[model samples]
Target: MQTDSKTIYTPFVRAKDSVWEVMSDVLLALIPCAVISYFAYGEAPLFVMFVAVISAMVGEFIFAGIFLKKWNTLLDGSAIVTAILLAFTLAPFTPWYVVAFGSAMAVIFGKILWGGLGRNMFNPALVGREFMTVFFPLVMTSRTIWYNKDYVNFQDLNIFNFLGNGGFTEYMNSIFFKPSGAIGEYSVLLLVLGGLYLLLRRRISWHIPFGLLVTFFILLQIFAFKDIKFSLGGILLGTLFMATDMPSSASTKMGKLYYGAMIGLVAMLCLLNDVKYEYMSYSILLVNGFVIPINWVFKPKVWGENINLKERVGAGVLLTIGIVATTYALVYLHHFDLVRYLIFAYILIVIGRFSFSKQLH
Candidate 1:
C-alpha cells in the first residue's frame, strides 16, 4: 500500500532546468531582500547569513564524505539555498554560534538524514528555523534584537499616518515595510517580485502559493477579519518561498492545491490559538507528512492500472465522515477541535481498514 516515492519529487515532467540553475535563480531573487537587510541592520545580518552558509556547506561536505561518498552532488547548490533560507528566518542579531548550529542541523538532520535534496520530506530551512525557535525562544523572539539604533523605524513614519486609518496604515506597513521581523521578510513587495521572477523563470509553479494565499485570505475574512493585518509578511514570505519548495511539497496538480489549502487552514487555526511565531513553518512541516498520501489519493490514472472500487468507496466514506466531523466540531467546539476530531477519525478508519483487509486475506 505504499505510493511510488520517485514520482513525488516534482511536477515538472520535462523541464530542462537543472537544480543548480534553479538554486542560482532563487539566490538571485533573494539578493534585493538581503541588500535591504544589510542596509537596515548593518553588518550583523550579513554575518549571520555568512555563518549560516558556511555552516551548511561544511555540514554537507562532511556528510557527503561520510555517507554519500561522492562529492559531485555537493555542487547542486541546494545546501547553500537551505543555508540562506535558514538565515533569512532568523533575527538580524542572532548569535553566530546559534546560526551555525541551526544551519548544521538543517543540512545534517533535515536534508542529509532524509537522503538529501529531492528525497527530503520536509523543508530543511524551516527545520533549522524551528530548532532555533524551540531551543532559543528568548533569543529568537527578543524584542531588543529587532531594533537597530542606526536605522529609523519604518512603522513610525508621519506619511503612513496620513495615508489612511490606523488599521489601514498598519496593514500597509505589515505588507510593504515592516521594520522588524526575520531578516528576509522585511517587505512583502520584494518577496512578491521574487516569486514572480521565479515564476517567469519557470523554476516554480503558481498553484501551491496561490492556493495557500487564497485559502488563508478567505479564512481571515470569514473568522478574523479584524486581525487581517497581523502577520501578512510572514504569510507572504512562507507561502512564496518555503511552502512552494518542490521536493518537499505536493507533485500532482490537484494534490498540490489541496496540500496548500490544508497548510493555510492549519496555519489560520494556529494563529487563532495565538501561536504566532511558529504557525507558518509548523503548518508547512505538518503538511509535508501528508504529501505522499495526498499524491496517492490524487494520483493520475495510468492506462493499464487497476482501479480498486472497494478502496475508492472506503475513501469516500472517510471523506463523508470528515466533512460531518468538521461541521460538528466547528459549530460546537473550539476551532482546533476540528483538527483533533479528524485525526481521531482518520486513525480509527485506518485501523479498521487494515483489520478488515487482514480478515479477508
Candidate 2:
C-alpha cells in the first residue's frame, strides 16, 4: 500500500516496515563502505559525511517545520540516507561548504519541496550531487581535489605491498585496496558486500540492479570494452544504490526492467566519448522524469476494470517524447553527432507507435 512510490492502481506485496527502520537498514549496509573509505583516505571522508548529514538534518528540520509545519518529519531518517548517499559520490577532499550546500539543497529543494520522502520525483541525494556539479564543477570533477596530503603520505603504508610491484600487480592492488575515484568508490569488495546486504534485507529488488549491470556490461563489451574497469566501480555504486531508488524509478515489475535497461543504455551512450565527470547521475535523473509515463504504459489490468484507450495512448505519447528527449540530451552532453542516434530512436518510436495503434484496434 505504498502509494507514494509504488502505484496505488495495483495490489502489489511489499515489506511492512517503518521509514526509520528501512533507512536504518540502508545505513547499516553503508557502514562497511564508510569504514573502508575512512581507512583509505583518512579523516577527509568522515568530514564530508558529517557535514553532509548535519546539513541535511538541519535543512529537514527548518524546511519541514516552517513550510510543511511537520516538525516530526525529521525523525524519518530519509534525510540521513540522502546525506550519506550524497557524501559517497563526492571526493574525500571536497570542501565542507560544498558538502553542506549540496546536503541543504537535497533536503530543501529535492525533498521538502516535493512534499518529502516518497513524493519526490528524482532521487534526493543525486539531486544534491547534481546541484554540486552545477555550482562547484571544479571541486566535483577535478582530480587534483580527489587526492590530498594524507592520501599521498598513506601510500607508503600500502597493505597490498605484499602483492609485490608491477603493472598487473599494481592494478590488482588498486582494485582490492583503494581505487582512485570518489571516497566511497574506493573499495569494490565492500560495495559489493553492501549491495548484497541490501538484497538480503529486501531493501532493493534484483530487477533494476541486474538489468542495469547486464545491459551496461554488454554495451561496454561492444563499444568501450577497455574502460570497463575504470567505470565499473562507479557504475556499481550507482546501480546498487541510486538507480534502484523506489520513489524515483518505475513502479511495475516490467516497468522496472525497462527503466533499468534504459538507464544503462543512456549512461553508456553518454560515456562513449571522452568526458569529464560521471554521467550516471545525469542518466538517473533524466530517467526519473519518465517514471510517470513508464508506470502508466506498463500498468497491469484489473480483472473487472474497463480499459481506457485515451489514457493508454496519452501515456504512449508521453513515453515517446521522454525517450526522444533523453536521447537528445545524452547526444548533446557528449557533443556527438545528433542526427544518427536521434533518427534511430525516432524510427523505433515510430515502429512502436504503429504496432501499438494496430493492437488498439
Candidate 3:
C-alpha cells in the first residue's frame, strides 16, 4: 500500500503568534521599568513617554500610508515600542517638542526609510537618540536638564568608595529608587526585572546580553576597578534594553557572541578614553552596521557539513591583527592609563584562544 504525503503551503505551519503579540509582550515587559521611571522622576517622565508614543504612532501611520500604502501596519505595535524606547533614552526634562521630533525621526528615517520594521539595519530608537545627540548635543548631555528633585548625589562616589563609606544600603536604594541619568536608566533593579520577564517569555535570547555584559564587566573591572557601578549600570541599560534589539542584532548564535563582544570592546574603548556622552548608544549603533557581515561570517552550521579550516584560520588571524592594531593605535595616540591593562587583557585572551584551539585539535 502506498501512502500520500501532504505539504503545507507558503507559511508552512502557521504561527499561533503574530507581530502584534510579540510587540505586546515587549511592551508588557517594559511596564515595570515604565512604572519605576514614573515614580522616580515624577510627571515629566510620564509626559515624555506619552508624547513619544503618540508621535511615533502618528509618524508610523502617515509613513505607512504614503510608502507602504498600508495604514493598518501600525497595528503591529512596533511604533509604540520605538517611541517608548526613544523616550527612555532622553532626559526627563527634554522639551516635549524634541521628544515628538525624535519619535518622528525614529519612525520616518529609521524605520520607514529602511523599508519598514524588520528591514531596518539599526534600532529605530537608537537612531533617534543618535540623531538628537548629533544635532542637539548640548540638550542631550546637559546636566541641568538631567537633574530632578529626586536626583541623587553621585559625585565622588565610585562603587568602592560608596561601599567603603558605609553607604552600601544607601547606594543600593539609590540604584533602585532614585532618579539619576537618563529617563529610563534610573532604576537598575527594575530594568533587570524587565529583562528577566523578556527572557522568561523567550522574546529575546540570553546569548547577546550575556556575552556583552560579561565582556563589559571583565574589561571594565580590569581597566576601571573603582567605578564598578558605572560599568554595571551601563551594561544593564545598554546590553539588556538596547543591544539585544531584535532587528539589529546578530541572527546566529555564534554571530551574537561576536557581535556582543565587539560592542563591549568598543564601549570599553569609549569609556576608558572619557568619551562620556552617548558612548553606549554609539557603540551599539556601530556594531549594528556590522551585523550583516558578522552573520555572514558566522553563519549557522549545517548538520553533518564539513567545517572549512582555511576560512576559520583566516578569520582568526584577521581578528588577532585587528586587536593588536587597535591596541597599538590607542597606546601610541592617546597614551591613556587603561591601554596598558588592555594590552595585558588581550594577551590573556590570545593565550586562552590558543589553549582552546589545541584542546579541540
Candidate 4:
C-alpha cells in the first residue's frame, strides 16, 4: 500500500491579522471623519469621495490587469484608502473629472507603476495631490469655492489669536461645525478621534504623530510665531493622516522620529517661503522620498551584532555627503534655469535605473 503524503510548508503558521484586516481597521477609523465631512460641507464632499474611491478602484483594476497581468489585487482595499486620502486633500468643490484623474494617477504612478502595494516608495494619495496641485492649481485652490469663500476673511488667522485669546473656542467651532478647508481637514476633532481609535487598536505607532506635533508646534513658535493657528491646522492634518502612513514611512523607531521631524521642519520652511496651498502634503511627499535613505541610516542592529569604528565613520561620511549633495542640488535648481531640463532628464534616468535594478534583484 502506498500512502499519498504531501510535505508541509515551513512552519505553516499564519498571522492572525492580514493586510485586508488592517485596511479594514483604517477604513473604520475614517468613518467618523467621512460623516463629519458630509455634515460640514454638504453633498459636495460626499460626491467627491464617491467619485475618487470608485475611480481609484477602477484604475487599479484596469492598470493591474493590463500591465501586470494579475487583477486580484482590487480586494486589498488599498486603492480605497488612497482614494479617501486623496479626496480628503482636495478642495470641497473639486470637479469630478479632476477627482477621477487624481485617483488614476495615484493608483497607477504612485502605486502600480512602482511595482504595487509593498514596493511603492511614496504615499499614493500624496503623489496624486501633489500632481494636481502642480498642474491644476486653479482647481485645487479655487478662491471661488464655497469653503474658501467662507474662510476668506480668516485667510491670515494666526495661532496667537487662535489659542492665546478666546480664539480656541472659535477655532474649535470652526473646525467642528463650519470647517472652511479641505473636506477632511475641516474637522480636527473627528480626525483626532479617529487617530486615537487607531492608536487604541495598535493599528499605528505614536512616534511619528507625536514627533510631528511637537516639532511643528516648536518650529512655528520660533519661525511664524503669529501664524500658530494656521501651523496647528497643518500639523494636525498631516500628522494624524499623512505622515503616519506606514509603508511610505520609516520602519525603525528612531527613523520615524527623524522622518517626522524632517516633515515638520520642511513644512515650516514652506510656510516661511509663502507656499500657501497644501504645503503639508508637499512637505510629507518631500520627506517620503527620503524614507529609504533614512531607513538605511537608522537600520536596526542585529542581535549580538557589533559596531566597528570604521563602519560608524563611513556612515557619518555618507550622511554628510548626502546632505551636501541635496542642498547643492536644490540651490543649483533654484538659481539655474538653463540646466533645469538636463538635470531633470538625468534624475529621471537615474530613477528609472534604480527602479529596474531593484526588480532584477
Candidate 5:
C-alpha cells in the first residue's frame, strides 16, 4: 500500500522526466527569439548569443567542478538554458565580455555559490541581469529595446555592430515575430506555445502565472499599464522567463498565489511610476529576491486541511490586534496616512474569496 501510494504521488513531485526536460524545453522555447534576432539585428544577435551561451555553459561546468568537486549538472543543459535566457534579455548589440561577465556571475554567484541547481534563492537569469544592471549599467540600459529608439545607449559596450544600423519599424517587427534574438524570446507567439507546452508538461504550476497575469494586467490597466490596452503578455513573459522559479517562488498553491500577487503588486507600482531603468528584468529580480523569506513564513493549509472556527477567529483577532498595534505605532511615528488601504486589502483578501456555501461532505 505504501509503495503504491508513493508511486501515485511521485509524478506530482518530479514530473515525467528529469532536469534535461527543463533544459530542452527552455531551449525549444528560445528558437523563435533566435530567428527574430537573426533578421532584425542581422548576425550580431547570433554572435552575441553564441558568446553568452558558451560563457554560461563554461561557467557552470567550471563552477560545478570546483564547488561540487565533481561533474554533476555540467552537461545537464541548465547552464545552456541560463545562458540563452540571459542573452535573450539583452539587446542584440551588447558586448561579448558583458555577456561573459553576466554569465559567470549567474553561474558562480547566483547559482553555484549557493550549492547549485535546486538550492539557489533567486533565478540565475535574474541574477545575471541584475549584475549587468549594477556592474555594467551602460550596456544593459543603453541597448535599445529592439525598437522605439534609433541608437544604442551611448554608454553600451557595443557587442555587435549590426544592431547600430537597423530600420526602426523593421527591428520592432522582428522583435514581435521574426526570428531575431537569443534562441526563443523574440517571437511572442512562439513563447506562448512553449509556455503552453510547459503547462501541459506540468513542468510548472499555473497558480503563480495566473496570479501574475491577472494581477499585473488588472493593476496595469487600472494604473500604468494602460498603454498596452489590457494585454496580459507582459505578465506572461514574466511567468515564463522569471517568476516560475521553482527554488525561489512559493512551494504550495496558496503560497505561490500570494507570492505572485505580491510580485504583481510591487511591479505594478514600479510600472506606474515609470521606472526609467530596465523594467521587466529588474522587477522580476526584485520579486525573486523577496520570495525566499515570503515562502519560508507563508505556508498555506493543505486541501482538506481542517481549520477550527475558534482558531480562525483567533487569527482574525490576532490580525486585528496587530493592525491596532500598528495603527498606534504609526500614530506615534506620524505615519498614519498610509493606513487608508489597510482595511481595503485586508477586507478583500480575507473576505472576498468566501462563498458562504453549504459545506461539502
Candidate 6:
C-alpha cells in the first residue's frame, strides 16, 4: 500500500528542445517589459537583467549537479526563465546589490532548496521579490525605479535623483520605461511584446497568463485605472507575462484560472489595503504554494478508499470547531495575525478533510 513520496513517473520527458523553447519564449515574452523599462528608466535596467540571469543560472547548475546530484541540463532553460522573470518583477533601477541579493534568493533559496526544477512548491521569482521586500523594505518600497519624464534627457541628474529620493509624481510624463523598478520591468510595452512572442512560440500555456491578465485588468480598472503607474496595460504586462510564468504555479486549466484569479484578487486587495509592491509577487508565490495540491486533486483519480461514518462526523465537527475558533479569534483580536499560527495546524485538518472526501492514490 505504501509508495515512494519522491517518485515521479512521467509519461513524457520534458523534451530535449522543450527547455530551449520555453526559455526562448520566456525571453521573447519579457522583451516588451525590458524595452519599456529601457525607454523610461535608462541604462541601469540592463544591469539588473544581467545580474538576475547570470546569478540564477549559475546557482541552478551548481545545485542541480553538486547539491541535487543531477546532470547538466542547464540547457533545459528553467533557471534562465526564473531569472528573467525575477528581473521583470523588480524595479529597473534598483541597486545592483539588491538585484544581486534577489538573484541569490531565487537561485539558492527559491528553487534549489525546494528540491530544484520541477519539485519546487513556490514560485522562484516571488521568492526573490519577497526576499527583497522583507530585508530592504526601505529601498524596495521607495519606487526608486519608477522614472519621471521631467528628468528625461537629463539622464544623469534624474537617474541619480531617482536613486536618492525621487517622487513618483515628479516623473509622470516619462512613462513606463524611463527608470522605474527592477530594471526592465517598468516597460509594459516591452514586457507585453515578450509575452506575445512566447505565446506565439508555445513555450507556455495561455491559460495562466490570460487568466491572470484578464482578472487583473478587471480589478485594475476599478481600483487603479487613474493611477499613472498602475494602468491597464502595465498591470496586464506584469501579471500576464511576469508573475504567471512562475513554473511552480498550477498547470491544469481550472487550477491555473483559480490560481491566477486568487493572485489578481489578492493583488487588488493588497493595493486597496495600501500595501506596496506591484502585482503582489509575494502573494503570487503564496497562491502558488497552495495550488500544488489543487492540481493533483483535480486530476482524474482511481478509486480505492472510502470514508467511515465516524471519521466523517469527526471531521465535520472538528472543522466546525476550527472555523468557529478562527472566527472568534479574528473578531476578538480585530486582526488575522493571531491566526497565522493556526494555519499550519489547519493545514493538517484541511488535508484530513480533503482526504476523507477522496479515494487513495
RMSD from true fold, candidate 5: 12.5
In model 6, where do residues sit more than 4 Å from their true spots? 1-16, 71-73, 143-182, 219-234, 301-361
> lDDT per residue, candidate 1, 152-216, as tens digits?
43343233566867888876655555657788887777888998999998777888887888888
In candidate 1, stretches whose alpha carbon ends up further than 4 angstroms from where it belongs are 1-14, 150-176, 225-229, 304-361
- Residue-level error in angstroms, candidate 4, position 251: 0.9
Task: Please list the C-alpha lDDT of all candidates, in the order they appear.
Answer: 0.74, 0.76, 0.71, 0.70, 0.60, 0.58
TM-score of each: 0.78, 0.80, 0.78, 0.79, 0.69, 0.67
Best by TM-score: 2
Q: Which candidate is the best by lDDT?
A: 2
Backbone clashes in model 2, listed as residue pairs: none
Question: Whole-model lDDT, candidate 2?
Answer: 0.76
The pairs that clash in candidate 4 are: 159-228, 159-229
Runs with alpha carbons beyond 4 Å of true place in candidate 3: 1-15, 150-168, 225-231, 316-361
**Candidate 5 lDDT over residue span 1-361, tens digit each:** 0132112111122555778877677677667656655655567778777887788888888867875666767666778877777777776767888878888878776677666777666678867766765677566656453442343222222233444666764554443554332333456665677678778777777888788778777776576525533223344566776778676676667657866766676566555445433345545655665554444344444466554667555654554344335334433322323322432342353223322221221
- Note each model's CA RMSD in angstroms: 7.7, 8.9, 11.7, 7.7, 12.5, 9.5
Which residue pairs of candidate 1 clash?
A: none
Candidate 5 — what's its lDDT? 0.60
| TM-score quality measure for candidate 4 | 0.79
Better of 2 and 3 by TM-score: 2
- In angstroms, the error of model 6 at 22 is 1.6
Q: Residue 8 of candidate 3: its Cα lDDT?
A: 12
Candidate 4 lDDT over 229-344, as tens digits, reads: 35344467678877877768877777788778777766666566555564687678767778767766666655566656687568746764564355345435434433335334
